[model samples]
Target: MKEKAEKNKLLIGIILVLCIVILGGVIYFMKQKDQNPDSAFKPDLDSNAAAMEQGDGEDEPDGIRIPGYPSITIDADTTDVKMNLMNPEGNPCYFTFEIILSDTNETIYTSKMVEPGKAITNVTLKHGLEAGEYPAVIRITTASLEDGSAMNGANVETTLVVQQQ
Candidate 1:
């Protein structure tokens, strides 16, 4: 009887030790996870914005006159869309308008480079998109210098929700 009791006590001790080990491991892992909450997910707001603004500027035959990003939106039917061109630079500039689809980064429409100070009317979209919400980013770039380098460039981003008709 004494030997049997001793054996039972030893088994219980081993089991307790194992339970403590498992519990400590669990606690340590939980603390580590708490320390790194972003391990599972991360977001790149800047890149996403850039992608949405596919047509940043229009490259003119003479030079590139990119317009600064402004408040732009697309209608649900994927038909009507408008963007206000804002020129932050004190000097007047021109813009080549282009429409890029958010989903596939596709260039749907483009316009001839329009000089600054002259406002452009509604620019139609070329490729019709399916019903879904999307981001419509407008890119503005200036003409490259004689060195064949792009000059002033800026990105203006906005969200567009396209619904079915």
Candidate 2:
């Protein structure tokens, strides 16, 4: 009877230790998952209209095309800015335009994905700026048409002229 009681206690102790180790492992994995939530999430390339607009031909350039931006002017009191954000034809990727203020590194405007041979004519700024000439950058981010993965991009430095109307 005494030997049987000792064996039962030993079995219970082993089981409890295994349960604790498994619980610790679960907690560790949960924390790791929280650290990198979007590691596995990939944006669908097909959903972007730009990806579908890619033209197939041997004439298309093998390399990415980076577009340039001229200095932009806008009214001080209004957030509406007239600009043309374009993705050149024969390019193989999509373009995303981001207009950032140079002094504060603040992004005033971000355009939707512009497909090849398409353009966004107007954009609403995040906020109106004071009447002054501000140095700015037009940061272009290119994404692959095949997989929506990020590709080589460009930053075109320009001036943002905010004038009182």
Candidate 3:
């Protein structure tokens, strides 16, 4: 009887240690996944801007099809939009930027021929738009590339809401 009790105590101790090890491994894996950009994790503005240049070629357009750009979200009171434009396709192309709100079309900004590869541009609006949901459209024209360049233009419409602070 004494020998059986001692063996039982030893088994319980080993089990507890195993559980602790498993728990630690799980926590470490969760942290690592959060740091991965490809995951559903959205980093701060600086990291997010860097990821804009990367994409999944599986969804990329073929033969001049415009790839959809990510949507933008901004606070209504934000007067200036800090943004970076990326040329994923390794070829030079032309692009036009516009905004449409409530059926009214207006040219908020434009980019003259973005050079091949990544071309980061900062566009400042002349006037701050009213706080509301608007359709952000980017029309890309590739007059040079033979395969039309795998250009995924802006597909995201920004929802600008002004919050009273």
Candidate 4:
């Protein structure tokens, strides 16, 4: 009886230690990821912005994320821009990304607290277009978290042709 009790106590001690180690590891990783959010960004999907079409320019991030380089299509007259996005995780209670038309530094889209497992799509752009060629500078900004605790951010840029409408 005494031996069995000692063995059970030892097993419990080992289990407790293991749990602590696992919890600590999780905390450490979370902190590291938070400190370097850009590192976690995945540029797997392609961006469907207007600039992508018509062989336009792209934003070059110093250390950020951008989906594979893909072009977008443009038509004459009125221009329509589309922006598609995927939420990174399911727990992003409130995450935000900013889309800017660089030419005028105008914010075309601002998504807030996008739900995870859901895809954000079909954001249209609005601006007067001329017959001449123009650089539709674009900028996309995303952060690591939503609780103001996030510091690292990622940005992407691209340009599009504005045909005279």
Taking all chains together, each candidate's TM-score versus the true structure is 0.43, 0.63, 0.44, 0.39
Model 4 TM-score, all chains together: 0.39
Q: Which ten residues in a row have the lowest lDDT in candidate 2?
A: 43-52
lDDT against the true structure, per candidate, is: 0.52, 0.79, 0.52, 0.49
TM-score of 1: 0.43
Could you list the CA RMSD of all candidates, in the order they appear? 16.0, 6.8, 16.2, 12.3
Error of 1 at 149 (Å): 8.2
Who wins the lDDT comparison? 2
- Mark the regions of model 4 whose C-alpha exceeds 4 Å error after superposition: 1-70, 74-80, 88-95, 126-148, 161-165
Candidate 3 accuracy as TM-score: 0.44
Q: Residue 157 in candidate 1 has what lDDT?
A: 62
- Summarize candidate 4's per-residue lDDT along 1-165 as a digit string, tens digits: 999999999999999999999999999999998889686544333243212121134443343334421333344455354445544333332235565655677775565534333445664545434544433333334444344344334454554444433
Highest-scoring model, TM-score: 2
Query: What 10-residue stretch in candidate 4 is worst by lDDT?
Result: 46-55
Instruction: State the displacement of the C-alpha of residue 160, model 2, in Å, after optimal TM-score superposition.
Output: 0.7
lDDT of 3 by residue, 9-62 (tens): 999999999999999999999999977656752212211223245455656454
Put down candidate 2 lDDT per residue, 28-58, tens digits, no spaces.
Answer: 9888987764755344322223322445654
Off by over 4 Å in 1: 1-71, 78-80, 86-92, 144-150, 163-165
